[model samples]
Target: MDNLQLIKSQQSKYDEIIEYLKQDNSYWLDNDIWNVEDKVFGEVEYKISAKNIRFDFIKNEVLKNEVKFYLVYSLKNKYLRLSKVLNEHQFAIKYVVEYVSKCLLNKTSFNEIHIDNNKWKLFLINNGISLNKNNQIHNTTYRGICSEISSFIRDFYDDREETEKDIWYSKNIKGAKIPATGVHGVNGHINFMSIPIYYRNTVKKYFKNIITKKSWNHCHQIISHLNYFFTKFYSNGYTDGFIENLLRNDIENYLYWLGNDYKDKNPTYRCKFVSYVRTFLEYIQMAQYDKAPKKEVSFLIFQDDIPKRELNKDEVKKVKFVPEPILKQLDNNIMDLDRPQYIPIYILLRETGWRGTDILNLRYDNCLDPIWNNKEQKYNYYLCGEITKTGIAELKIPIRDKVAEMVQKSIDKAKDLSTEENNPKKYLFNTYEGKLKGKPLNKQSLLNTIKRLIEQKDIRDVNDELYHFRLHSLRHTRAKEYVEQGMGISIIQQILGHQSLQMTVHYATVTENTLYEKWKNTENLDLFRVNTETSRLEQVDLNSDDGENLIRYEYVKKNLDAVRVPFGVCFKPSKLPCKQQMNHCLTCASFCTTVENIPEYEEEIDHVKKQIEVSERCGRELWAEKNKAYLRLLKATLERVREQKIVHKNGKSREEV
Candidate 1:
C-alpha cells in the first residue's frame, strides 16, 4: 500500500486497541494495573469496535466514584485493540484490579479479582487489591519509565518474525511498534505516542479553558482564533494576504498585541499560544495542504538592532601604545590575578600584528625558526593555528629585533612557570599552568581586559569610541605602516595573510606626512647633486689607485660621460689643425703634405695622422688623446730608425762605431 493507506491502517489498529481496553476492563483488573493518582486523565470517553472508533460524551457510573481510577498499561501491548476493550466483558472486568490498586495506594476500600490457570485469584492488599504473578506494578517515580516502556515495545516488534499468512491475510500486524522515545522518533516523523504523554497533558493544563470542553472543538477554536488574529494583522482589503504577502507589518502587530492585550497572562502562556499557533500552522500545512504565512513575517517579529563603528588612526595609536600608567593600574587590580601570562600576549599583539583570536590561541610550537639563506637563523614567529571564525589561517611575520628579544625573555620566564607537572598546550598566555580556565585567558575575557585598559587611560574623547580599538585594528595599523613605507601591495597582502588583494588595499592608508616627504625629496636638486658627486669619487678611487692607472682613467672617463660629475675636468679637443699646423684638418688638403715631405718617414707619418683624425672626429676623446701622444713618440722613433738605415745603406756606420 502507499504511505497514506499505511497510516490509515495503523490508525484503525490504534482504534481497535482503544476498543479492546474499554471492553475488557476485567482483563486490566486481573493484570493489576494502576494509573498515577495525581495526574489528570482524559475525561473525554472513547467508543470503539473492530471497524471504527468514535467519541462519546456519556459519563460512566464507575468514573463518578470518590476514588476514580484508570488502567495504565505499557504501550508494548499493541496487539490489544480498542475494539476488544469496548466489546469484551473480560476487559471491563479487569478495571476492578486497576481501581483496587489505586484505592489501596490512597488507603480507600476497593475489591479486585484475577484469573490464574482458569482459577480466580482474589487479591487482598492495603485497600482490597491483590498483586498477581503476571501483573507488573510500575511506581511512577522511576526515572525514564515511559522511555523504557517505549524502547521495550520497539525492540519487541523489531524482533518479531513475519509469516506469509500474517502479512497477506491479517487485518493488521500484531504488536505494531511506536517510534523510539525522545529525539529518535520512528520513521523520523513526530512521535504520536510520546507527544500525548508529555506535551498534550501540559497543553491541556495551560489551555484548560479551551481544552476541557471537547478535543475537536478546542482544536478548532484555537485554530480559528489564531486565524482571526493573523487575518486582521496581515490581510489587506482585497485579499486575505495572510499566506504569502504579509511580512514585517504582520509580525510587529502580533508582537504588540501579545505584549499589550495579554499583559495579565503569564509569559509562558503567551509563549505557548505563539508556539501552538506555529505548530498548528505547520501541522495544517503538512496534513491538509494548507500554506503558512511568509517566513520573513515571523523573523521580523522579534528583531534587534546593533550599532556598527570603526577605529580612527589616533584611537588605533592609543591601543598600540597603552601607557605604563594604564598598565600599572591594570596590574594593581590584576596582581592578585596572573598578569605575567597576559603581558606576552599584549606584546605579541603590538609586535606581530595578530588579531585577538590568533593571539589568544598562540602556542609555543607556532614560533618556528625560519631558515634564512638555507642557514639556521633566529626564530621567526609564525602563527600556525585556525582562525576563530575562519578555519586554518596561518600568519608568518618576521619577528622585529626588539620583539624577538622580548619573546626570548618571555620564553625563559615561561620555562620557569612550566613545572614538570604542566601541559604546554594549555596556553602561552595562561596565568595558570595547565587548564584553560583560571590560568589561561579566554577570548571574551581578553577583550574585556583590553577594554578596561582603554577606559582607565582616560584617553577617549567625547567623539571617540574607545571600544573600537579591537585587536584587529592593531593588525590594520601594522599594514598601514608598511603601505606608508612604500611597500608593494602584493607584498603587504602576503604579510597580512589576506587571500584577496582588495582586503590588503583596504588597510593601506596614505597619510599627508608621507605625501609631503615624497614631494620634498623628489624636488631637492642640491641633494641630488651631492649624491652624484659622491658616487663619482668612489668610482675614481676604484679605478685610479693601481698599476693600470692610465688605462683605468681612460676606462673610467669613457663611462663617466653619461654620469654627472660635479667637480671634474672634461677635455674637449677643438678642431684646430694638428697643433703643428694652423688650420683644421678637414679644411687642409695640404694636411698630408707635412707628413709626405718627410720622405725618410713619409709612410709612417701618413698612417699616424690618419688614425688621429679618425679618432678625434668620432668623439673618442680619451682614445684620441692617447693616440696623439703615441703618434709623436712613434714619429721620433721612426726618424731615428730611418737615419740608421741610411747610414747602413752608405757603409759609414761601421767606421763611426
Candidate 2:
C-alpha cells in the first residue's frame, strides 16, 4: 500500500478505538464526558474529550524534552502493537510524527482525520526527518506520541477523582484510611474510627435505601445530612451505640445541636436535615425484622425549634405579581434572546401559565398536536399536559397562531435530529448545545440562562425592590392578568392545574393593589358628612317625564355595578330570592357604592317612603305594617351607601367603612 493509504488506515483505526472508548461503560468516569485538559509547565497543553484531542507545545527545548519522555515507558508496548499494523516500509519511517504533524494539526476531531489527497505526504517528506527506510528510531517517536495522549487522559482522571467527592468512595475505599473530614467535611474527611466499623455495613444498607428513589444530586445532599447527623451523634458521647439503639431523645438532642450551631441557617435546610434523620430512623425500624420497637418520629416536637416563613396579615395582602407593562416588556425581551430555543420556553410559561417543570416535561403525543387539520390547511394548536407538581392533566389551552407556528418549527427541528424510541420527537424543548445537547433541557439550565439574561438586561420588579425574576413569576403574571380581567377563581384554578381552589387563590390570585387603587380613586372627604337636612331637597318625578326618563334607571344600575366593595356588588339581580331583596348586598364585601351612585340610593329611599305613604293613605294597616320594614331597610341601605361613598371618595379610614 502507498504511504497515504497506510496513513488513512491508521486514522480510521484510531477513530474506531476512540469511539469504542466513548461507548465503553468502564473506560471513563462518565461515559458522557466533555472536554478536559491539563497544561504541563505552562508550555505544553493537552486536551481531550470523548471525540477529540489537542496537544500544543511551545517548541521550547525544556517542554519538548519533557513531552518526549512523559510516559514513553508505559506506552511503548501499545505503540509497538499499533505500528505492527503498518507495512514494513511504512514502519521504517516516522509514522507517528507524520500522523501528528499531518493529521492532528489539520483535523479538529478524530473523525475528521482522513486523507484529503492533498500535499500532506509531500510536506512530511520535505520536513526532512530521516527518510532512509533503514531507520529504527522512527518507532521511538511513535511511542512518544502515544505516551503524551495517555498521560493526558491519566492526569485528567486523577484530577477529577481528587476534586469530585463521590459518596460511593466512602463505603468502597477500604483499608485506604478514611480522611480526617467525613464525606461532607471541608478539611479532610471524617476518620473511619469515629463511626464504628461493626455498624458500617448497616449504615451502607440504610444509605442505599435512602438513595433508592433520589437523583444523584439529591443523594449527595442526603449523604451529607446523614454524615453530619452521624458525626454529631458520635461526638456527643454516644460512640458505643448503633443507629437502631438510639432513642428519640438522642435524635432530638442532635437536632437541637443543629439548631444551636446553625442558628443562622434557613429553616428549609434545617428541615431537610431533620427529614433525612427521620427517614434514616424509619429505615432502621423497617430493617428490624418486624420485632423492632416502633419509634414515633414526629416533626411536632421540633416545630417551634425550627424557624418558619410566615407572612403577616398586612404582608399577605400585598403579593408580588409582575406588573402588566413590565411583563409586556419582558415578553418582548425574551423574544429577542440570542437563543431561539428558550423563546418558546419563556413564552409557554408566560402564555399557558403552567409551571416550568410541566412545560419542560411536555411530551409529543399527548401534550401537543403538530397538525390540527388537513383539508383546511390551518392549525388548531393546544397545550395538553399534566402538571408535574399536582399530577393534574386537564390542560386544553388554545394556542395563538404565531406561538403555534413557533412550536411547530421547534418540533420540526427536534424531529429532524431525534433518534428517541419509535418517535422522532421526545421533549418539546431539547438542549441546543453542550454535554446535554439534543437531550431534554433541564430546569436548572433554563433557570441559569434566564437569570443571566435578567441580570444583563437589568429586568426588575416594578416596585423597585430587588425582585429577581424567577421562572415561576411568569405563571404569577398570567394569573394576575386573568383575575384583573374578572375571570372566575374556579376557571383560573383549572388553568393553573391546581388540585385545590385554595392553592389557586394563594398562588395565582390578584393582590390587594387592585382593590386599593379602586378605593383610592373614589375617595372624597366631603361624603363623610351625614346630610340629614338633604331630605327636603326636590326629587325628580319619573312619571311626569317622557320615556327618556328610563335612561336614569339604566344610568343608576350601571353605576351600581361599577362600584365594588369588600362584601359584594351593590346591585342584586332581580331573579335571586332574598328576604332583603334589593337591599340584600348591603354592608357585604361585594357591596359597593360610589359618589356617583348616591343619587340612585336616594331615589330608592324616596320610592320606599312613597310606598309607605300609599299604604297608610289607603287605610290598609296590615300592608302599612309590612311596608314599614321595607322603609326601614331602604333607610339603612341609603345610610350605608352614603357612608361608603363618602369613605371611598374622601380616602377615609377603611375601619370607618
Candidate 3:
C-alpha cells in the first residue's frame, strides 16, 4: 500500500470526519474487514488499483456503523483512491481507527467525545506515541496524527452540531465565503472545548458572535491570546476563570506583569497581546455577567497602555516597494511564472493593488467588469473584490486594459479545468486536481513560486543582492502611484480599503517610490555643503556634521527635503522670517536647491503646466504668463539637478564662484 500509490491527501483523516461528513447518506458497518478495492484503472500507472483496509476492531454495532458512514462519505466526496485513503498519511486512517476503538472502550461514542478522556491523550504522550507500545511511533509522526484527530474532534462539532451549538463555522454562515466578506480561506479547526470549562462556556458564546463576522485566523489569534491569559492566571494561583472578580489594583498588577515580562521584546508584541486581552475583558465586563470582574476592564486599559513605535528623528521608517527594475524583471518573466494562472494574480496585484487573498480567491466570471470611458471612446476595466480586513465589501477598483486581458485568460483557464459547481466558489485560481481541488490557490504555493522564479531569473536589487519580493509592498507601491499622481488622500483611502484616515495618510505620505529609486537618487549618494557667506556649493565630509563643515547624512535622508519644504533648502536661520512670498522662495537669493529636489522639481513643472491650462481656460492672460515663467524656472532647475551642476540662488557653478 505504501509504494503502490502517491498519497496526496494533505488533510488529516480526522479532518475528513468533519469536512466529508455525510451522516444522512446511506451506508452501514455490517462486516469487520471493510473490503474497499480501487477500480481506478487508467493510463496513470503505478496507482494502486487494489488494496484491503481492515476495520475489524470495532465491536460496537452502532459506533462502527457511524464510522463506516463517515469513511464512506469521505470516499464518495474526496478525489482519493482507496489505496491513497488507507495509505500511511502519517498513520492516516489506521491511526484514526485505533483512536476510535479506544474511545469505545473508554465508554465514549462518536456523537459524544469528552474533553477529559485521558486514554486518548495517552496515545499522544510526549515520550513517543502509539497504542500498547512505548517509543515505537516517532514523535513527528504521531504528533501530526494527534493534530489531525484534534482537528477532527473540533470540526466535528462544527459540521455535525452547527445548529446545536452557539458557535457556527464560517462555511455554515451564509455569504461568509462570498467575495463581499473577503475570501473564505482555509477552514482551520478551533478547539473551544479544550479551554477550562469555567472559561469555555462564556468563550464559546463570545466566539459564536465573532465567528459569523470575522475570519477563522482572527478567531484563532484571539483564542491564542486568551489561552496565554488563562495559563498566566492558573500559574499565578487564580483558579477563577472568565467570571473572576478582581479589583482595579489586581487589573493594574496584571498589566504591570504583562509589560514587565515582555519588556525585553518588541513593545508592539506586548502592546498587541495586551490589546487583544483588553478586547475580551471589555466584552465580558460589558455583557453584564453576574460573575464578571468588579473592575471596569475598558477603564483599566488606557490609550497609553498600547505602545507606539518610538523612533528617533534620524530613524528611517523603512518603506518597502518592489523597485522599477525588479518590477520590470517580473513583468518580462511573467510567462515563466511557475503557475501560469498566477501571472494574472501578479498583474492584478501590481495593477489594482488588492491584497493577494482577494485577488487569488476572486469569483472567475464576476470579477472583471467594464465601463465605457466616453472620453477615451473605449471600455475601462475594474477589478471587483472585497476587503475583509477593513470591512469593505464588493469594491470595484479600476484596472488597466492589459491587466483585464490577463485576468480574462485566467478565467478562461479556470472554466476549462473546473465548472462553477466543481469549484463552487468558481475561484479564478484553484488546484486543477487533488483532494484540494476547487479550493482557492494556496498563498504559500504562490510565495514558493515567486521564490523559485526569483532564484531562476536572478532577480536582484540595485547593489546586485538577490531581491526577495514582499507581496504587501505592491499595495504600498500602488498607494505611492496614487499619491504621486496627486490623488486625494480620502480617495486613496477608499481605494486601498483603509478604515482610518490616519492609516491612509501613512501609506500615502511615505511614498518612497522604491528602495531602488531611493538608492539611485539618495542612499549613501552624496551630501553638499554650501558656504553661507560665499554661496559656493561643494561636497561635504559625510562623517563630520560640525556646523559649516558638514550636515548630518541621516538627518538629510530622513527628511526628504531639508525642513520638509518642496522647493529645497533655505539658507535662512530657523528663527528668521522669510519676506518672500510662498513658493516664490525658489527665486529668492536666500533659497538653496540641490539634486535631492530633482523629482519634486519635475513634479512642480507638471503642476505649473496644469496651472497654466486652468488660467488659460479662464481667459486670465497675466496668470497664464506667470505660470509659464514659473514653469521655465522649474525646468532650468531640473536640468541643473540632472547634470549634478547645482549652484544655488547665486546661479553660478562652484568653479565659477
Q: Best candidate per lDDT, number?
A: 3
What local lDDT score does residue 469 receive in model 1, on the 0 to 100 scale?
A: 42
Instruction: Write the residue-wise lDDT of candidate 1 on 259-352 in tens digits.
Output: 6766765554466446556555444334433244446333543423111123444555554422334335443554233334556666676565
The reply for model 2, stretches above 4 Å from the true place, is 1-221, 240-242, 279-294, 298-321, 369-382, 386-409, 420-425, 432-434, 441-469, 482-506, 509-512, 518-527, 530-657
For model 2, residues 1-657, the per-residue Cα lDDT tens digits are: 697975676555544444433432422212222122322112212331232122232223222222222222122212222122222212322343345455567533322333331344334455553434543223334323333333333332232342222224333334232211112211122222223455555555665554334433355566577778777877777754445355657766876898888877666557777776666666666677232225544522344544454445555665556666667667677766665577788888878888787787666546666556787788777877755345443477777778777777777776775665433336667654543444466666577777767666777775665346667777888888777656788988888888788777776565567667546434421223344788543433445553245545444423322212222223444345555443355535555556776676677666555554544433345444544665576566667657765533334556466
Question: In model 3, which runs have C-alpha deviations exceeding 4 angstroms?
Answer: 1-168, 175-187, 241-244, 260-264, 309-319, 371-380, 405-418, 429-434, 461-467, 484-488, 501-657
lDDT of each residue in 564-608, candidate 3, tens digit only? 234443334434554442247676667777787777777767656
- Per-model C-alpha lDDT, please? 0.42, 0.51, 0.61
Q: Rank the candidates by TM-score, best first.
A: 3, 2, 1
The TM-score obtained by model 3 is 0.61
Which pairs of residues collide in candidate 3? none
Candidates' TM-scores?
0.30, 0.46, 0.61
Q: Backbone clash tally for model 3?
A: 0
